[model samples]
Target: MATLTHRRIPGRVRDMPSDFPQVPVQDNETSLDGPREAKAFLYKFSQAVEESDWKSFEGLFAEQCWWKDHLTLTFDKRTIQGRQGISSAWQSLAPQRKPRGFSIAGPGIEMVETPPAFVRMTPQMATLDIPFAFSVSRPDCACVGIAKAIPSASSWKIWVLTTSVVSLKEYPFQPLPRAVTSNDLISPEQRGKATPQGLPHFQEALDAVVIGGGCSGLSNLIMLDSIGANVACFDLGSPGEAWLQRYRSVRLHHPNFMIQLPKYPVPADIASTHLNGAELAQYMSRAVQDLKLPLFAGVKVTSNVFDQERRLWTVSLEEVQSGQTSTVQTRNIIISHGFYFNEDCPVIPEGLKDRGKFSGPVQHTTQFSTTDLYEGKRTVIVGSGNSAHDIAKFLGDNAAVQSVTMLQRSPTAVFDFDTFHPFITALYQGNIPVDTADFLFSQLPLGILRDWMGGAIAELVKSSEKLYSKLEAKGYLIDRKPNFIQRVYEDRVRSIYFDAAGAFDLVLRDRIKIAHGTVVGFTENGLIVKDAETEAERILEADGVVLATGYAKTDLPKQWAKSGFLDAESALQIENMGMPAVDVEGEMIGQVTRSGHPQLYFSGYIFSAARSFSRFVAIQIMADINGQAPEHGLP
Candidate 1:
């Protein structure tokens, strides 16, 4: 194994941009009515913070105020209530832990007024649209802080502060160079005349043919390659293209440690809290390259036939870009194409398929990107999943959007990100290594974990009655079942949304309308949605419709058959393979057929955490190829 030198990037803070736009002001104004007072308060606050005047800072906040930190200042998640608690938390910082310098400036300020019924704090609060910078000298790291202020007793105080490390942009962690020597990567000349196996093969007979090139596929390939297996990976698009194709704003809800690729730990310095789509894609590509895995990008598998007598799989591959084709033989096949291979749009009832009559664009959520194109249009986003909420929030935030509505046919389980943040922080942020944390987390049985999480969620809901009550009053359906995690387990689908992304707040504010109904059909100018309870139909006028209905569970064998990758008989055999049943040793029970589908495997489609599950899957694959028991139970 090769190692890279650890370097800490320097941190710095800068003033907010002068021309930055402020948040739109609300109708009510109490204390700190305008930007003038807010600006003065911010200046004084920054000065006191720089001077380490905990006493002065403590005096600014009310006796009972909320302070939330998201991966800023502390490199951990923290929610401190009450001025004394906040002061104690700050005062407890190590002597050497003070930021080198901190400054604040902003585009402007706006006053946000919350209903007295919604919060225990003052109803009227001033929110400064300030940009802040924090730097530490010892570690040489810097970050940009997006800070806001609210009215406390007699003056304005810091309410919410969110930070993103600035150094990750300039200094990202790079994977080690390719491990394969010259002889390891077979040359085209060598491949042309190679006939190690009697069957027709491209390059050579591979130990395994791994399909798909997303996070799961790449992780499996890396592990197999490390174990010296002759494996080749194939994908219809570029490696990591699945992640690259997500919406621009899509980000992993899990923390850094939870989502690391197999064998490759995400360096702590490279934005080590969360990753957006682009960052994740880059990391996947690097992992593939660093492992020197044989990845055939832009190649699609066209046919696969199992030869029972030979105990081998004859596979045909087609180059998607060019019309070229080839063949290969493999001892094993691993389907890593993900669970949601098929997009699931709502079933349009009879008489609703008049495509020529509808005037606007209708597309699945996968096809929808930023809201730049829908500027003056009234858009209706269908569904209540994470994507739906994200899209709705994006559209609601866009000033140019005439109107945005989210149509939810059923209740969705939504939890605030804060509920899980502290636990994740405790598990992965401090002394605990990611592998150790993952091992400890996996040690708990699925049912036990679900029950524990249910209790925690119940407590969280009870504690946040004000917030939940507000959501319910706004007509948003909230699931009152076994909490979010248990509900997810029961449904076998990720039907939960993290509420910290501002979507729930927007719904409550009526900035994003929520319509509870099933979409019956589309009219010439809009959609006909029927209420579930009343069965009353209402026309929702929209210039565009986004179907955030999610994807169908992919039947791998059936998909392969439809795509001409498997013969009818073999496809039927696999179709009947039924629900995946795993033995105690983590091997698939009854997955292989009499026709010699040597260890046809399914992975990466479970409801648990994908990264952790993929790690176990890779181990299982390695164990199967090497004829050893898996170190851990099946994924």
Candidate 2:
């Protein structure tokens, strides 16, 4: 078997150039030669690619452009800008992968079995997105590509190209072996306990080693296990400890049914749309034990050493309580510190004065589990986000509380979540299979979604005029000025506070007071805030302060390098990523950062990341270890 080092994805993700040459506007209805030209272009395009004709490939693209590949030819999600780079990549992989059978989707080319996928136009960008299907020479691979075309002198030229693996012939997504929801119909004794349990200790060496046992880590673990991969997961605390440690009142922002893990899902019988923190933790823990997943709880991954020559990884684990240590070698390492995504670690603002003079309870929202201790005391909650909103509402609903104030520096956008967001109604709630739902939802390109959503968001924003007028009366600074794209993607969490959180409802009724200002510093009695509009200083008296400020970003890569046998260059090759910002190029970052160590994968951030994107990770790793012999790992 050939050494797998040559398959390394670039360590650093190439940031797409911002100064793109704008496309000249044409009539959206007729600019694109509609399906005819698109079919011909793709037909020739597939021929050129499969035959390794670089010249033809280059000629088909515009002078300046970007090609975004998502687990297709590259088997990794990334965007390549410029004709040269894209051509070079396709030229290298096309021959080995043998990507042929191109069609306008309905052409019914030989070996192509996809439906009539068609061309779509974006009036905002004056670009046409043409979806096509193709076959790969590699066993068990089905590929799809979307080409974005702009007007040229005579016809359309490929501006931005996108390719992805729709499915694998060998590893198709299957329903969980057991019922995801718990069955309560049987009596406790009749149900009977399992006769035995799957061992928690993993084999000394494995195909994949997963770090971080939070939601994302567990999701990945479930997927890899379902596919029969020799995998194990390790975390510093018990499984689901991240959620277990949160406030009791903390509930999921989305519905329980829609927020399904890879295999284990929340029981469908729950009455509320929201699942509180405890319920979430129990579901995660039960999934591990019931499935008998190889999850080593209360263990930390202190070091991970990757060997490019042998294409393996030696991971060192440490027991949190006894200081015991062990090592195991594997072909791949997945870093899924779920909490580290965009919402770093808990951040304590610098301005809080800690002198003995200001003697009152101060805590982050994560720490403020209940209002039992400070029932009659005035409370001021810092930050304006999911946690902050929920905390404020929680405090307001308690009649024992004297007053509750929400301190936020930035503007916020609020909307009825189920009504406003399409995901809740369109794909997740329907009768479609979970696998099909997740795949289709994941495949919707951001470039097209942004254009499609901008107008809808604009309409929604206009309709909220009455809502905004009420919020303004309550001293709330609405996100009146929002970038159409950012409102949906990048600035989504910060700006759009879901109505499910209920902070908005309380504020409208004066139950939870709203204060829009910057916390310049903390006062003896409360925080010193500068009004957002006036810049005038004011002091709000509070018996306690809950800093709902976001979690600070953890340096997981640096932490992993602590004890690993990393060469200087290999060390340099490791990188991590959260959600990429939203834009033409930024949206492509949703794929795991493919640069850095070839054997290392850090799938961090976003709720569904590890689950939604884990199949590719499993596929890539399985591909690497297929023909290779299992080496004696570090003892």
Candidate 3:
């Protein structure tokens, strides 16, 4: 094993004209042949990186040209400033390397943009896959570099090369013991041969493959696509249902007017205010339709393989409608499959798993839909969140259900929740100190606070009797007052409010009851609630219990083990409190480490480290995957 260190060769410069030549941007199809153009650019780029040919690499950069390595928000806008600046930067920073044969292992390009001819060359850029090693450094430290090509002096040249490292010791393609899911438990014999080699050719080919339809997967698809890479997206639902699957009762805390797909604006009618589940679904469906995005919907990517020789990814997929298995290949794969893939129902305690055998029906919240499930039964809802409030209110109206009991381990602070622009505006203004409104509005994150204020105002207006009565006469609310600051506020204030801890005043007075206690264990009839404050235990019987306990992070994709992409040690290499590791931009650290492979990225709750503890926000997820945050972090 060797460690990379930058070394300078004294008097390495070959005498040439001091007045630097003006570089040109390369056209999208410079060579007329895409493969040849791709290979030629990659070869030259490798030569420059290995031999410390800074001048050659820099000569390819067009004025104000930028390079995104997929992690950095702002691309590398390297300023040549007469060759010396270029040479100095590379010589002092790049890892020492010796040529170990260079080759274009894969040929795939996603055309980002095509600018007309500029600066004696066409201005265009695409991301391509190339595999190489730093021989002078660690042999095991292999990397797949995503390089950019530019035109300079009648030839295409490599402009920027961002390398992500991969090591066999850390990530292997071997199968481990299978973990059980709700469907079934595994038998040792079923493990069979779980190696990349066992899969048929083309059975596993992917650089990064994403397997869920939710925000995480959609955003990842856009990011991987942005880099001009061929990534396959698999999900059991329609392309956007993952974000739209929330119960109809849900609405985005942020107004639809501010939150939208990248480069595309939301529909005018839909953009005016908060978005509901159906509206969100329509938005995603529209994106898919508008982009004509490639997707394998109603199909789930079940497993994958890491092909070492081809340096590609192979995934095993089951098409739900067809009941058939197929595979796809690529060099990198992303498991944007969401965290809540399968509903994570709470684990009934050892004592409680059996309590169900003694009495009434025991069901988890995932199976819950209406109050009718508890109508006639002695309904007991465990947890203090919004669901409890809704469930209590629902069951209160049922004649069959004797009573609805809510078990709370802790109390919550409730607040008013509304969905109009003016209401948010007024509230935001109210929350601000009288003298600091202007300053606060200017400095707030994404102008979210300002939007809040505007929305508060809008709500106040809509709720007024005069306005409501007029709208009632017209059969709908039609008040549309424009505040010049509304758009500005929306642009600046983009935060969404979630009322997980808000008050539930409507349910405060009712036959429904609230109990605060700890569960010591379960008995044959019901649960034993022990009061920590009183040193006493109470036995309560219920027809059913809904455990609203939270969730724990799971491994990115189950097949990473079978494919030997990650071993136990390497799995631990990227962890945040037991979750997978990720950079500030929400890119899984394993995929970004200088030693990790380029064919991988991550999403879902694993990104909690970056976004304060909120994981599934679709807009934030989109921004991170699109490389919005700085490579290292945000200011």
Candidate 4:
């Protein structure tokens, strides 16, 4: 909250044209003693802290540096941005937290899977990245940190340092034994429904209330339960309803092996190349039920008030079908409503130039279930986004439809699955363990990752050039944001169409046409649209229009204010809460889990973050409620 800033990493800048190898390489791999030197640097760092030598500790960092701490010393995921901030944090929180026994995380030079420490070059800078592990003894926790160093004054000076609390010592997330007997998996029988012990309805107060029973909320519940915190999730529909209600052709592109909830792998029997939305929903619901996770199905939060005196929230809930209302109490609230949600109705467009002259049916993507309903009907999809393309594919593939066209307001970045697979899919696919894949990604902060991702994306785009060239030749406009990571910042999900050859093949084959224009007005049986590039106005005849323009971001603060869910102080604490943390240049640096208010955590995250890092969110809430991480936690 103090300042929003940017510090460009020194090297072959991504998003800029460069002939040098995109992969940062050490000047001399054989000559570099990276592991030994990095270990020595870490030793000095530990010694300085142990001796309470503030000057020596300050000297360990570069002038421009960052320290991202995730509940290690600070209960919040905070980025201390400078040497001053870093030194001040260490001075204030170190003695009390008592972090010690620092050592290299793994077999530094020999290991390949766990991402060992190394030295790499950027043409201008030689950087040493060392991943280390340490023990936090005050409350008893296991933590890890990675320090990026550059040689300055003939010594390695760290520029970026990340310290994360992996887990608490008492409530350890022990992995199930690799070789186990049938007796190890057996469990005692439960009484009524298979659900975690908590308020079945709105019968009693709770420690945590997770709104949105989808993956995000469910994942958070798992973590909260692991930490021994009483938590429950609420959804507007029954489990898997959100996914099952999506259009019939909805299928996820993510690798199935990497998409499972924590400690709950998708069943082997239902595995496929692409996970169907309905299948995923069923699996998630079944997983929750089997795990005994508490979920209040078919219920939604109507309103709530945060009690400052009691440090609790009294939430109003209503059953969708029964029209029954109830109140539940909670000390902490996590709004894990997720990035993409299924709404009962589509987003009604507000400002169409014409007033009620169109005779054609207008449907939102949410309302369109099947192409069978529009037999022999001409359809115009209003957006060139992922949903628009999917709808176009369905209409084009259906033999009954006369024609299907996509009216684009702006150029869309589309990459076929084969080309885009290497960057995202390949990482998760091969024999690499899921944890190792995740650990490799967790090694660097997103900002630095963005710098490197541009290179990988650039290489992939070379293979996708033909795909783009052919589309542009067919009148479809295309644009590529420098880094795909920025897409996550702007869209919360991958906005670029990972064209899976169904809709894309149709478009390229001319079965489905693409138009570059905006719908300005409507005709009696069609739409009057304006060309984006030129001032030409045109008419697209259609029997119906599907608004795949997507929905607006949820303004939770406004809704909360209107419904008295938060006080002025807490409202300000969480003001502008949900969104990835970005630098001044608008490059996403990190994902935010804090709202300035420690107890009121926001976990409305992307799919991967929601599934992988929900534990971090849960532990923070646990810290707040149990006083492990205070409201005014470490800086």
Candidate 5:
């Protein structure tokens, strides 16, 4: 690799109050008292990156920290393994890097939902998403990258960094640098290896078989084994592959504290308080090691058949590494397997299915990652979720990409990465004992009277000109008091606002483009949009298009339902909208497929309906399942 001297590029900075809408730091909530600490930390951290100050960045890590960035699909992306590992990853990248645009203290924190669950543990981790532009050689050549960080001690530090060079053709409207070819980013090995093929069954003689090694499966296995239940758990290899398989720029909305699984805590020394998909997955892997839990990697459970004569559930599995088939019989069956394994890709656009005709490379969000493949192509990303935002922002920095447009169906609720502080994380996980009815009544949009009161209080405080004095006068003594309900409202409100606002700004500045309308259909050449007011359809051209549309629930096993243990209606009873139906009690109305099958249960993401508030937080789901298991006799 050739060494490139680092140069600083000027960019706009966002102004976030050091203590605006501040709240009292409650120990139980894991709140940090003031913004001075946060602001200073951001300043120093930003400086380190700006100047390639590796030592300063390294100094920010905790001794026991773990680093991860799965969303970028850069499984081998830069991570500060331990406090010192920060320097290791950076030193290598520093030799050929340039810095462009810097913004510190991206967003403020807010609580979402709080409910009591099985896990009562306090807040333990925090994470943040930091955005930047990277320049390789000429000043005009820049790419977008994300630095996801978490809180350590009194300051924040980088946990993971994923950058990709983009092209002008991809973002013709944006003022980004030229595109980088696959040779510039992806390694030969990554591109050459075939996607992992399904393996033959592993013929291991096991007493118990567990499917899905994600948090839920891992947790169930740990408990079953602890109770001396002979058990073997399995998931497709890559430990936290799902996280790695996502678009690279994604970050969790909740903090690390609420995401940790039982007996496997988020490391006290994590690189960031918030985590991206990769980091979360890495943490899961570390948990397996730290807990010394027995886990089978690269193993997939193809089927689970129950035998009426044997009075046992037969679990069939395939080991990707070794070509063999195996079956196991368990005294009791625990279905902790989650639902995110398969991709819920949209029905291929009628005319675009034969993508070769479009004369451009098109891909799914599931396969979308860095900008190496997008350096010089015009890109149109479909969908309005976080995945779409990440890809748009990433491609916006490319020079070769002619233009980038993010198509949306409707506005979405967006929140700052910081809103996921450990305390807030707990709140989002619905683990806090706060009243849900009260929160909804007080926080929902219809609660106008309460919002007005909050607004009045805010006005008075602003009038005082001194937040601390205003707080003290109101029998409060904080620099700023976070409007609980307003904060909640802002979380949803700001997501739509920020993305739209940011996209609008990009448009005004000619950095990117935005279109709002209903997608009528897809043509071989481009898309047709129906204008809401004019009711007229307009066609647009593009070099490539990506569906940022969200995912759907995984299809349930046909075999299980075929056994007569579960009825279609009863199954629907468990489904809430696109998610699975879970009771407030976190109980999944599991059906015994065999009709006479013994007590069987379902937990994890597949059980989405009842997991509403805490679905984003895996640890919360684990706690809920553990707490509710006894009621269903799930052992």
Candidate 6:
């Protein structure tokens, strides 16, 4: 790699406060690497903080620096800009004045290549833990601090600092107290025979039974098995079957680091940067085998019934191939079926209801196999989310396809993936570990985080003004309000697309036509779409129509009730709990609901960027089963 030198422009220097403590300057022209300099700087900085030497602490920062406080040290989020601002903020929010004294501990320092920067220090701190019943009330609780600095003429001057707290139990990568012995390395049969003293052994009646064998379900199984719980997992198909069934071209939208599974991460050799569907399935398969989880594959869960008197769930299972039936009783049941449990295809318009009337075939996005099916023909794709955009681009670029048109009901919030690559790299790459980045990113409150993201979106739109203008010129509608994250959280649907692919460029160049309308009815050739602006109906010519309008909310609780898996009252209780039942503490709302359904739990329902949220769900489930659930009201 070539080294780039950064020229520092001369700037005005602020005078030190008269009351601040003065320290002797270190040697100016010493030769030290980034890590060495960072460690030396932290030593002085920590000493200054411990002694309450505000002047020495303030002197270490550059004239223009930023200090960001996540939810760890401060109850509210803050970004203090400039040396003066940072000094004032720290003075006002002095740690010594608070009930607990703050101290820096276990700092990990690394070098950054860009901006001619040298050291980036990430230190772990010890402080009072959050006042949750499940939390350990230790004086030395773990937290994280990040500091960045550049080599100045005199010495290394700090430029940016950030801090946040981490949950030991929630983060799966963190080591647990349990000791793994040689027996833990034994075969599944031997391990099953040697049970923990308190926990029940694996048998027909299990302590817990998790449904689904995909990423989410597998995550739960890993956590449960780690705690020596006699747990069993069942799925309709094989492990990672959903990913195997996806289109061949489908790669994970997020980077590999973001999609990693807790406890069992994707191996470094297997495309550590990004993973296709098949690759992800392969990783999950290995994880299932390595964990020695009791997984019943190719088994369909026919029904689940809760026995009120026994406080146990009796689940009816059937072998898909042989049609053989069996049953199992478990104390706790976790419905880990993912959000996309069923495909939702809109009813065919009244005009095209008759098969004889329409020549072309109409199908849902799920039924779509490959582009070869629509070769040398025109195709219309409905909706404007990621899937719709991907399908439109695929059809448009196909050599045989005559043309591709996208029918979007409303404007979509689209931004180039490159626009956020720097941010993503900073969070997931370099000195900071992905898990630490995840913890810090989740520290801010939702409302505050949304406001910050909204600002970022505005700046991004301004930066890509010309590209957006081209999109607008080509009749594409863009929505900027609420930002992407807010929209995803509010509506379960993913309404934004990260333009890592060439979909945006295709739309701009008219390779794919964008039609802003709603399908009121359908015609034989294509479909009749009503324009949003003019309210005029137009006929679009196409050989087939793909409905990418997203999945229907079948109400899992209601379906479970109808199947006799849960009582009508319990189902209603879960239904009223809303999607995922997330509380303010970021825990699922009903780990132990007000009704106290101890054996009932849910997973794979929350919308979070960090795939590790599944791990937190598993932790809460384990806590609940072990009678360690926090005794608090719903957040």
* Best-performing candidate as measured by TM-score: 4
lDDT of candidate 6 over 1-635, digit per residue (tens): 00011211111111111111122333532243444555566677666665767788888787766665432333223445567767666655555222133333332411111112232121221111111111121212234455655445676566556554333234333332234454332235432111111222334566678887777777666666665555677777766667666656676766666666656557877864667777887777776666556666777777777777876778787777677778888777776766433543233444445545557757666777578777877888878887888878778778798788888888888878788566545566525555555654554434335555666678777887778788889888887663454344434545777776679878877889988788876677778888778999998777887777766545666666787756676676553333332333222233222223445655554322324444444444444555544332111
Q: Tens digits of per-residue lDDT for model 1 on 357-430?
A: 67887767778777777789899988888888888887889889889998888887777778746754565663
- Per-residue CA lDDT of model 5 for 1-635, tens digit only, reads 00011111111111111111112333543343323443455567668866778887787654544333211111111122355654565555444443434433122201112211112111332344444433433212324444445554565554444343322111112111112233222122221111233332333333345566766776565544433334456677656777787677666654554555643457876787668778877787776655545566776666665555664566666667775767555534445554433354343445444554455667777778777676666678776555666678768866777788876554443322322133233343544322221122222111323344355445544544443342233221132344433322222111222232133334445566666666666666677777767889887777678876544444454433554433443333232222333221112223111112233344444211122111112211222223311111011
Higher-TM-score candidate of 4 and 6: 4
lDDT for 447 in candidate 6 is 38
lDDT of 2: 0.63
Model 1 spans > 4 angstroms off: 1-202, 344-356, 424-426, 482-494, 575-597, 606-635
TM-scores, each model vs. reference: 0.63, 0.77, 0.49, 0.84, 0.50, 0.70
Segments of candidate 6 deviating more than 4 angstroms: 1-204, 340-356, 576-596, 605-612, 633-635
Error of 1 at 286 (Å): 1.9
lDDT of 5: 0.44
Ranking by lDDT: 4, 2, 6, 1, 5, 3
lDDT of each: 0.56, 0.63, 0.42, 0.66, 0.44, 0.56
- Check candidate 6 and list the clashing pairs: 304-565, 376-400
Q: Write the residue-wise lDDT of candidate 2 on 69-99 in tens digits.
A: 6666665555566788878877777666667
Candidate 3: where is the Cα deviation over 4 Å? 1-208, 240-251, 257-259, 264-273, 340-350, 356-358, 386-402, 411-414, 418-503, 523-525, 553-598, 605-635
lDDT of 5 at 259: 54
